[model samples]
Target: MNLRRLKYFVKVVDIGSMTQAADVLHIAQPALSQQLATLEGEVRQQLLVRTKRGVTPTEAGKVLYGHAQLILRQCDQARVDMDAAGRGLSGAVAVGLAPGTAAAGLALPLLRTVRARHPGVLLYLNETYGSTLSELVMNGRMDLAVLYGGRVAVHGLQFLPLLKEQLFVVGPASLPAPPEHVPLRLLGEMDLYLARPYNVVRKMVDEAFAGIGLAPRVVAEIESASTLTAVIADGLGATILPESMARTVVGACKAWQCRIIEPVIEAPLALCQSDHLPLTEPAQAIKEILLELVAALPGSLIAGDDTRLSVS
Candidate 1:
């Protein structure tokens, strides 16, 4: 099948209308429709169902769409590689950032660095929960990720240790100030609001409590950082998170408060990528930039008296 025809068919399925796809592809509607017909003919299967409402892919079309997407991405990458053969670093690199401090602080600076240093490079960033980011990186959807604790062997991905971030007990300003440093037992005793078990930070928190034979009094399981902060700020309950997250949350509404955890439960941040697929040149450059940036983060964001971990 022709790559151009496959691309046209994929575009049509994506937009669900030949006319709209034609407008985006800058090809005439009839020509686009003809390419789809040719693609279906080559496959000897009906790919799309046309209707007045719009177009929907048939089962065969759906399968073809998945393969077509990968093919087109590879084609684009090939073009980029060829264009950058003897020139400066130029290509697309996708990096994933875990939803808390990494997303809150790192993205803007990383984007600026990419723009200033490698103007030819295109960076796509995904900011989400660590679990999602892990899956994306392992499945070849994301090139790299900055996330919290996880096994180095999971999904055959490489997890290079970055730095540990201290967890803090955050509450509303209306509540009486707890000690500057709160104990794990005290944290467990309080009505705590935390992320669900799927979150990497939540897993770390759970494991830390379980390690000391304590069952935390979690009053709510929330997935959204904003919602958790809002609830804690409204005096609903207290939550535990990194200092950077606390700063971001309280920056918006000054009613939130935080205290460093005594004996300090620290979450190890790691840079992860699939070892099966080697990093491209541009990806490697961006990775180095991220590592440098993480190393230079202020002491407030870095756990006090904590040493950075290095792992190849």
Candidate 2:
């Protein structure tokens, strides 16, 4: 079987649509279809079940898909290994980041470090919600991701705790001071603006409130950190955030008042990757750099208080 054809088939199954796969592969639909036909002919088995919405792998296709991923990853690793002989590690590595995960401080620094030290290696970064990042890492779309350790379902992924950040109740500075820390049950009295339930922080907040026999009095369900910050700073409502995120992404540290939750809710930033797929050299190098950088952050941000409980 042609490796190129196998690659194309894998892309089709990954995208779950012939048209979408053709678009991503930068080839005509007819040419892509011809390639798939040739692949099935060589294997003598139907691989995909076509449907109006998209395509799904047949039972046989499911088996091949797993092997195809390993084969493709190995082929890429082989090229990177050969290139490392003189060119320093060389290949592409994609990493996903959860939103409000300090991309401003982490992503740019990571890019600069890779460019300066490993000129031949290419780094691609994607920033999205924690749930989305989790799915990407689990599906092998991302080589690795930094996500909430508690929120992720780690069926096929390995999660390593990097740091634990305490969540704070952020509000306008003009508001009355809520002591050094506010009780979790007291959060029900505030005009809370929070992300929807799908968000990691929201899930944690819900559970924390439930544990205390109270529900947050949410006035708004906002997904954008900027909007949440703006509204909260304007005295519209209050929101919860990690210390690092409040200091970096949310900015206006002086304008907003942050009170630690009484029973601190610290979410861990975990490095997650597929358990079945080994990291390529380029990916491993990048991972090391990320770990080292995070290790240097303020004690408040890198606190490993719950590191022992974050293993997955």
Candidate 3:
């Protein structure tokens, strides 16, 4: 009925246990149970059913849960609206960044711009992988995220295309230059430095090799982009990475990048936000700053058209 009760209900639903919810909400288990009981009595419906595994929302509870989320979002929006009316931008914004390309090259300058333009806005950044970041945005844990294009389908989310980065063949500069742009077939025998299976880039690389009818021989599986680049620079193995990552390596190591021919894989980067939840004023301001930063980068760099370059 009230915002406080709705917030508690949401927390309980998210945590899926009265005891855990009480711990998170900083209330006694008895008090939390009593509150849910009172709420159920008022609504004249069974909201939750307990099972050995955990608590599950009843049919009626499911309906109420949906309404509860909307009400809580509206309450938060009201507060944000009032604050924005008095001050231009003075609220918190939480933004998530996926690993690989966007986090390193795209997000930092935008964060700087937001700090400069809206000093009152509190910025929170989380470094996460693509699929996880998408779910976080959908569940209202993050206001927005920079994500890889083909990996996630943001069902009820708005996506703004930021840039497109092509895949590159990376290795030590001391190695023989692969005839200008190297074809995928030429690298079939090379040992590959790859990310884990869950990584979006790793999946893309797998698909690319499959498309070319060549199976890559992965020598090492690394989670961090910098580590992969370091291994490649040491001539331990070659790698297939985004052009953004290649630029990053060229700046940090003695590495060279060759464009992948035949199936030139280009991954698009997008600014994603939930369509169901409206952005706070602070979040909107941050989004604007990010778009501006993307626009300011050179067309080739922004479009992932830069053939070879060091990270700026």
List all candidate RMSDs to the true structure: 4.9, 4.3, 5.8
Model 1 stretches with alpha carbons more than 4 Å out: 17-64, 138-141, 211-214, 250-264, 297-312
- Which portions of model 2 miss their true places by more than 4 Å? 10-35, 41-44, 49-70, 102-104, 150-153, 300-310
Clashes of 1: 0
lDDT of 3: 0.76
Q: Which residue pairs clash in candidate 1?
A: none
Ranking by lDDT: 1, 2, 3
Tell me the TM-score of model 3.
Answer: 0.79
RMSD of 2: 4.3
Candidate 3 per-residue lDDT over residues 1-312, each given as its tens digit: 767777888788888998899999999999988998888998999999978777888999988987798677767767877867866677778888787774557667866777788887888888877778877777776888877763454466767667677888888877765876888888899878887877777788788889878888998888777677778678787788888777777778887889988887877777778777777777877776666666665432343332211111
**For model 2, where is the 10-residue window of minimal lDDT?**
300-309
Candidate 2 has which clashing residue pairs, if any? none
Residue 295 lDDT in candidate 2: 71
Model 1: per-residue lDDT, tens digit, 21-67?
99999998988888888888999999999999899999999889877
CA lDDT of every candidate: 0.79, 0.78, 0.76
Better model by lDDT: candidate 1 vs candidate 2? 1
Model 2 scores what on Cα lDDT? 0.78
Higher-lDDT candidate of 1 and 3: 1
